[model samples]
Target: MAKEYEFTQIIKDHEGVIFKITTIYTNNHEDQKDLYQEIVYQLWKSFDNFRGDSKISTWMYRVGLNTAITRLKKEKRKGNQIGIDQVIMKQTDQYDTEFEERLKILYAHIHGLNELEKGLMLLLLEGKKYEEIASITGLSPSNVGTRISRIKQKLKTQIVKK
Candidate 1:
């Protein structure tokens, strides 16, 4: 396949990763959509620079996360926001009210995390090993392990406080 075709195919295969990164950065649906578009745009611009040193998915996560964190900071600086009414919520399958509420609250806490922790936790939740997380984030594996432990403790404390 051509480079373009290969990139497009790989992106299609892992489309969920784009949204997963975006959602960690923004709860606002409009912000999420904007961030998603920007991540795709960044990915396209840098695709040629990707030399397959890591897995394509790894490359995607690195680019997607860097784009999201940059975009998030830009949005925060601009203080521009859409009205809640203008925000579009994606439909999800209905779960029992209690389960739904808990899921929502869990996501809320995840969203409250700082930029680095958000990426770390999201990667961990995706079942990335500490070494993989370290590779993506450029931290040492031991450092990644320590941070994940700390993050877990913090999240548990936060949950207890709620």
Candidate 2:
């Protein structure tokens, strides 16, 4: 059907966004896959309701983030699950050892952040403007700017302490 084809194409085009979000929210490979599937399912479920009021990517980000955050909360209520401590680096051939180490450290710090901060940092790192980030996050542009400034300072202090 045309609807199915359109949905599949949209998912293919934005799969990286889903992957990044799942990676950021989950520690282990299995959990990441589960989250990824869940996000895709949620997106598909709401596909009919999309009105084109925003960029498709923005809508995807909002839906993906909300689903991830909600899942984390549900997971917490269900009790602690063991997470893999090792960082799994992708595309090692594209980066030097130094860059890989830096990335590991950065991800560790990112994982330490609370959920909201983690979501904000992911969007910021994606090169989204403050207004777009706000639209995705349901925050005002000024608040997004303020939170990003604070998160940067927090990350800098954390790195300096290491």
Candidate 3:
């Protein structure tokens, strides 16, 4: 269908945003890919709900993040580990450098965070301000700021020890 083609094109145009969310939420290659597919599926399913109330990317992020979070929960309930550590290791093996090592550690720390925190960090990494993150996450602006500060401090401490 022409509509489907246009919709897929729109999603492809914003694929990186979805990939970022998927990467943050899932560590294992399998889970990351599964979650990526799930996000795309959800976007397609919810396309009709788009009412131009917010930016298209904003809506996509909300839906994709929510779907990824929910899928993580479901997988956990099924006793799956998501294998993010393995994925990181494989990635690190491709480049044996201090930066990749540090990045792997940071990724591990991020993987340990809750779903909401992961979403917030992804948005922050994308250069969103606290207010924008709060809008998408339903947290108070101050709370988002506080959480980012704390996360940064935690990462700083970890990086110092390495």
- The top-ranked prediction according to lDDT is 2
Please estimate how well model 3 matches the true structure, expressed as its whole-model Cα lDDT.
0.78
Per-model TM-score on C-alpha atoms: 0.84, 0.85, 0.78
The CA lDDT at 12 in model 3 is: 68
Superior candidate under lDDT, 2 versus 3: 2
The numbered model that scores best in TM-score is 2
Which clashing pairs does model 1 show?
none
| Model 1: how far residue 89 lies from native, Å | 7.7
lDDT of 2 by residue, 1-162 (tens): 999999999998998899889889988766776677779889999998997989999999999999998874334333343442232335476799998898878789999899999999999999999999999999999999999999999989897897
- The sequence of per-residue lDDT tens digits that candidate 1 reaches over residues 54-154 is 89989999999988877634444344544422323343555777887887887988987888999999999999998899999999999999999999999
- Model 2 has an lDDT value of 0.85
Clashes of each: 0, 0, 3
**Candidate 2 displacement at residue 70 in angstroms:** 0.8
How well is each residue in 1-162 modelled by candidate 3, as lDDT tens digits?
Answer: 987998979886997887778768775776776787778889999888887788887888889888987773445434454443532335555876988887777788888676667888888988987788888888999999999998888778766876
After superposition, the stretches of candidate 1 with alpha carbons farther than 4 Å from their true spots are 72-89, 93-98
| Candidate 2 lDDT score at position 149 | 93
Rank the models by lDDT, top first. Answer: 2, 1, 3
Of 2 and 3, which scores higher on TM-score? 2
